[model samples]
Target chain A: MRMPKLTAFLMATAVFASALVASADEVHVLNWKGYGADEPWAIAAFEKATGNKVVNDFFNSEQEMLTKLRTNPGLYDVVMINAAFNDQAMAEKLIQPIDVSKIPNYADISADKAGSPMLARDGKVYGVPWVWGLTALAINEKAFETPPTSIAEMWNEAHKGRVTIRDDAVEAVQFGAIATGQNINDIKDMEAVKAKLTSLMPQIKTFWSSENDWNQMVASNQIDIGTYWSGSADRAKTHFKLPVSLVIPREGAVAWLDAFSIPVGAKNVAGAEAFINTMIDPKFYVEWVTKVGAPVSANAKAVAALPEDAFNRKVMGDPGVAKRIQFQAPISDAQREAYLALWQELKVNVK
Target chain B: MAGQVATGARSGLRSALPLLVPAYLWLTVAIFMPLSAMVFFSFMTELPLSGKAWSFTLDNYATFFAQGLYRTLLLASLKLGLEVTLWCVVIGYPAAYVLAKVFRGRSREAIFLLVILPFWSNGLVRIFSWAMVLREGGILDTALNAVLPFKINIDLMYSYPAVIIGLVHSYVPYMVLTCYLTLQAIDDSLIEAGRSLGASRLQMLKRVIIPLSMPGLVAGAALIFVPVVGSFMEPRILGGRTGTFYGTIIEDQFVAVFNWPLGAALSFILLAVVLVILALASPVLKRAA
Candidate 1:
């Protein structure tokens, strides 16, 4: 009994010393929902690859993420935000720049977009590209006998009571601006946005906050057609037997990209960079896209490496479609305020 | 004799002090401090000349009231609240009675549990589940087309009805519990006496139960009405872009607009409006009393 006790004590001491010597790291990643699969397998793979724990948090809107950060700084280590808000965050010293030399996997991003003037500002690097796509109106094939082709057709009387719109202020106003031949970048007054929404509101069945609304609308055939992200069509198609088409309006569409940025006061900067690089790794990149069920910003190598069927999915059809999708730059503060004020009025007065 | 009476009074005061301390502390810590901060901040604005630091301003209030949009939302929110409260009362009263009176013991508990089962999950989860059911390819349509070979455009995901239904579902459990406690506490003899007087079933329920349950009903109504007026999630989630309630306006000022002053001023205005409503309703409540 004494000999057995001594052996057990020695084993316990050895294990304790090993644990003390083991390197441990944690990376706090903030992004949208469906980015990380809330499964043990996914987390374990990430942890095993780079001895770090990733803490995932989700935000509903670009405003929501920035609102929390502005109200309280240093709360998040890394936050995924839009290009428009990131400018504000950088100006406020709320977030820091990613060291370009540290991110070798960024080279894997497509050649066409590698040097695009859209990603940088004032010779400094800020945002890393996340989502690459155009906003298109998703047509519910079952709801309409003849699918609405022209952007103006969404306002047609035939689909009056059974149409839905998203709650985004910029998309609705920008899309309407395009149709009206108004320069979207140069809108001054709130009146124009209100005018656009007031016209659009009468025909809308509802306004959706999330992509779930689009998925449900197309699947259920409740609203005939709706403005949605290109990725939404792909998700809707998987769930619904109906052939959902991306209607790129002649008027033009609001392009969007979500990006990852480290906060200026990030404690685990090295670990955060490591996690980002790992995410861009080909196998992990494919897994995230496959599981996420969305389009990607990864260059040809990553896309080429994907399984044949997954790679050839209709979501990423033409590379040129991406260029047509404009990015949201930092609009003047006055214009941003005008847009929001107009959006609020449209909410109340819309019949 | 004077000293004896004074000591007795002091002891009485001392004994009651512990019980009341918590209530005061609860309100002070949870409600008063935060509200005071918000009130303070409402007057505070970032003056560009002074940099990012907040400065005193009434521009927030001026902006809120100057526009008709802000006030309109308050009215819409109140309307939505009142409408939902009425539905909750109508639906909750019978459901509570069936669980409390018709069903007894474990079965009663089971029925009550079933009503509360959604609460155990999450309000958001249930709303999304409804979205799945009511959407074009939702379970309802799937089940419907299976039975009847037909198609219909019944997308109920992002309309006014969605918010209403979601709000009522979230609050109906509270209504049921309040009504249940009120009904259960009633003297059976009063009900029996009504029956003895040769009153019909509906008459006894109308005369005895409703009047007796009025206090709980009134309290529950007030509880639901106040929060329902401030409901932000339901409008954003269910109403989508198709429809909106007043909560969205409040959210706009603070989040999207970054106009905290205006949001706070608008909130105060809304408070006054609700108080006015409750004040006006007091007469009806007194009559019920």
Candidate 2:
């Protein structure tokens, strides 16, 4: 009787141990494509170090990501959201405040980026700065004898019908404001924005919406200059061998920063924190920046550690280049509506 | 016997339910439910799914009136649709007529397949392919430059003409297919009869062939016009900066601006306009049928 009881106890212990071994801590990350720590070595090391698995879901745009997060609460443990959208995400209680104590590498981020209002709210830190990029002017190098240095160059009569702009209303309106020497951020006066944007109509050959479309135009010599992300121009030159170059106009460019935030009701907060820390590890950041081309990492050590080759792309690792970036502040919902309304009018009257 | 007949009719319906249910159920779930939901959401202040404060309001519709932009864009889109449909009719009807009446046997079948071969591949990819042909220094440019003594620049990449070309190319196949279907059913005897009655070829075509094929023409026009009016992708890819339409604005609301209620209102209004158009065309269609 004693022997049989001991055998049953051993069998139950074996079953319980198997269950424990099967269930690993998981961190579900919602981010843009190519934004996550996608390197095999990084992923493997992370999994081995923390015994947690990272699963990723990607969104093409901020609004799409917002829609997914808003519709499915607690679905994602970690989200890499645009800094401009952090306010709205927090206001809606979609994401929760971060405990800095849980993320040790959070301290290694540059002070300027760390102290930005985008990552903090009500004196409580909400996000860890991840990567930074800019939406600047991309020009075909062969189109002009000299490099254009000002945003106003886009509207010059000489380049009439040879230029393109992004098909984004806010960005277009902001550029218009900047061009006309009006405040890009506040944008209180609708008529001013309208007048400025409408003045650009004669010069615009077309408005491109996608990077691929812009690249094709450049390759086919359809447009002399256009508005696209700075990193995309770098990628195009390196990958497609396009004769394109990115320019930061004297009027300043709209800069965006992406950061990692934990959503409210996240099932694995600890694992999410670990994943965020792992992402900012200098070794991982180096690999990420090297592989992904020239988007700056917020971590100072990572920037310092980048080899001369990756560091040569001054836009990526140079702090001086970052100073030229004018970060876009979050806008009120009403402002968004008014801007879209005016933009629609501008589009209708483009001819 | 009357009771037996009633029972037979009931049994027929019962047997048909299985076949009808799958399709009707799919339509109800996929089409009707979303459409009804859109109408319901159009009257709201905010998206209820967002868990934000919201209320019922017609201000969304009122904005359409308060601002004339939506109406203007809608008019522009309709004009685009009309232009594309007319071009397709001019270009496609003749090709379709040849396919139906001119050629015979294997060649006709093969040509018909070639005409619609584009529809098989992805629509977006096909639109992109046109960029290689229509843009500056593209196939058309290289070909033209190769033959001409002097250089003549051909840069239609982001122009209104480019948009029209892309749209017509995308939708002309519909015209061919529909016109071919109806034109094929017309008997040769009717043409011979018209000829015997002292009618000329043009007269026979104008009075007989055209009138007989009115159903296909109307059907093709409706089919082409509806989608073209709602097209945003073709214009974006081919029209460049010149490509904002009513459909693109509606798209902006959902994806760019994150305003579902407003987008829903815009979509619902578009649906109403489309329904009215289809309604107006129904009488002519019925007569032709």
TM-score (0 to 1) of chain B for each candidate: 0.89, 0.94
At residue B134, what lDDT does model 1 achieve?
64
lDDT per residue (tens digit) for residues A231-280 in model 1: 66765665444567667765667766566678776777877777666656
Expressed as tens digits, the lDDT of each residue in B1-289 for candidate 1 is: 4355446777876776687689879878556765765677668775221136667888877886788777677778888999999999999989988876788899998898899887898777887777777666677767887888676655666678878888899999889988999988888889888998999998988888899888879888988998899888777777766456566676666656556566666777777788999999999997895
Top of the candidates by TM-score: 2
- Worst ten-residue run, lDDT, model 1 chain A? A1-10
DockQ (Cα-based) for each candidate: 0.27, 0.33
* Model 2 chain A weakest 10-residue run by lDDT: A1-10
lDDT of 2 by residue, A103-188 (tens): 98988998989999988989998889987778889899988888899988887888888888887878888877767666668766
Residue A198 lDDT (model 2) = 85
TM-score of each: 0.77, 0.91
Predicted candidate 2 versus true structure: per-residue lDDT over B66-88, tens digit per residue: 77788988888889999999999
